[model samples]
Target: MAVSAIATPVAASSGSFLISPNVGLMLWTLILFGISMFVLWKLAFPRISEALDRRQRAIEESIDAAERTREESRELLEEYRERLREARSQAEEIIERARRTAEVHERDTQAEAQARREQLMEQTRREIATETRRAIDEIRREVADLTVMATEKVTRKTLTEEDQRRLVEEALGELDFSALAPAREE
Candidate 1:
């Protein structure tokens, strides 16, 4: 009986419509699938597409902002480099000006020192000339007095002023006084 029952169920299942192709069921399944697709297209598809579009726009805006920021950074970097170059040029110019000023100051100082040295040398020469003249005059007076005294002693008579003047003139004319003067430098 159990064998018969199992054989009967297997035979019935083998002839069942579920295992065989049925045009009615296929048509009904197709109709249900189309209805479900139409419902999703009308309700879920628009919301999903709108969300995707919003995401795409947000991504594009972020990219645009990043690009703008990169361009601004590039501009700022260029500006900084330009400013640095200007600063270096200004620094070099300042150094050059200072160098020129220092050179001028050095030259002026040397020239001033040279002028002072020349002035002092001229003053010393003048003083030496004045002293030499005074010494020579003193020597001349002494010699004149000595000559008068010797003349009076030798002649055994007092010489008059005229005789003394004549003798002194003759003695002064015989002496060479040029050697007493200082030699000129140039």
Candidate 2:
């Protein structure tokens, strides 16, 4: 019926009311638009705006939480890196200390070996000197015995112990026995 009423006016006017404006229709359209806008503002607009505000708050909170988490992770990474660097430095120090200890040990060992070798050489020299003195004494005794026997044969008689001793001493004094001994090294 309302469509017929609107159509009747267009039929009577013979010109479209959309082309030539109708004051009554324009007034009713304005009233209806205002009422609809008022209803939406009171009901739908508040709900939509509240939903949009909730979504914005949620997104901002999520972003802030993510930023905090990122900062914490960065700090943890830096701490891990620092610990690694300290570990590497400690390892290097340990290696260096070990090397120094080994070097010191080697030097001490070499010194001890050298000292032992020198001691052995000195002992050998002392033994050689003792043996040389013993041999010279034995040779002197043999020469003294031979001289007494030769004198007994030449004189056709045994001599007294005092005379034999004097002859052996004179013979020993005339002999240069130092050349027969081994040479000493400095």
Candidate 3:
């Protein structure tokens, strides 16, 4: 029994006293596994879960805010487009109205000018006709007197007043002077 005890294996040596046997290694492994489980349950698992939850909430909030901002911007763009269209229509209408007004004024001015020109022409024509009549009457009287005097000189006879008048009137009637005259004056 003493020899068998001496031959039995032992992890510790008589000279080196730092470690003992396989039981200590088993105890260390069990203790390390227990501590790892405690850390995961008490600190690591909860912190990881909390971080995941916070990240999910932040992503959701960001998406909602982005959607809201996009909608507001779209509405503003639509409003601006409508206003621009309305202003363009109004500007076109104003321009058309101004063009119509100018045409009307131009027509009125032309009509007035034509009427004034017609009036002036008519007045000038009347003055010309009056002057021509006066000229013809003066020429007729002078020619009548001249013809009577020439008859008296050629016949060498003193004629009666009625004879002289008739001869002079007949000679004046033979020469027509009424067809060659201007119808208007300046």
Candidate 4:
């Protein structure tokens, strides 16, 4: 029995490296390995691979959605900037229009004031002319009365109406009206 066991070990070694002489054990091990591979291909491995593929697809969808969101945010930012620029332009235009309106109103106010001043000046001139004319007329009447009295005293008698009128006319012709009234400055 010991010699037979030794011969079997030698024959097994001569055949191949790491080979055993127990055929039944090797056959049983091969059958168990095959069953494990079939079970993995049909059930466990397929389920695990499906789970991994589903996770990969989900990741790809999430990345695509993130890219779309980024694009949309960029467009919105540009749109908001354009709106802000338009608002600023409108504000500047409004300010400019208000300034122009104020200038026109100021000019109109100045023109009205100038016209009123001119009207007041013209009225004053008319009043002064009327007063001057009245003064001159009063002086003429008093001078005529004095001349008539002087003549009557010199003659030692009251003169007739005709003689008084003739003497008053002579006095008025000798008087210079330009000397009594001053020239007006333009």
Candidate closest to the true structure, highest lDDT: 2
How well is each residue in 64-123 modelled by candidate 2, as lDDT tens digits?
999999999999999999999999999999999999999999999999999999999989
Predicted structure with the largest TM-score when compared to the true one: 1
Q: How many angstroms is residue 96 displaced in model 4 relative to the true structure, after the best TM-score fit?
A: 2.3
Which stretches of candidate 3 lie above 4 Å from their native place? 1-42, 125-186
Compose the digit string of candidate 1's lDDT tens values, residues 19-54.
Answer: 445668879999999999999999999999999999
What tens-digit string does per-residue lDDT give for candidate 4 at 14-120?
56444445668868999999999999989999899999999999999999999999999999999999999999999999999999999999999999999999989
lDDT of 3 by residue, 64-127 (tens): 9999999999999999999999999999999999999999999989999999899898888878
The TM-score of candidate 2 is: 0.59
Q: Candidate 1 vs candidate 4: which has greater lDDT?
A: 1
User: What order do candidates take by lDDT, descending?
Assistant: 2, 1, 4, 3
Q: Provide the lowest-lDDT 10-residue window in model 2.
A: 12-21
The residue-level lDDT of candidate 2 at 61 comes to 99
TM-score to true structure, per model: 0.62, 0.59, 0.44, 0.55
**Once superposed on the true structure, which residue ranges of model 4 sit more than 4 Å away at CA?**
1-53, 143-174, 182-186
Off by over 4 Å in 2: 1-13, 130-174
What does the lDDT come to for candidate 1?
0.89
Native-referenced Cα lDDT, model 3: 0.82
Ranking by TM-score: 1, 2, 4, 3
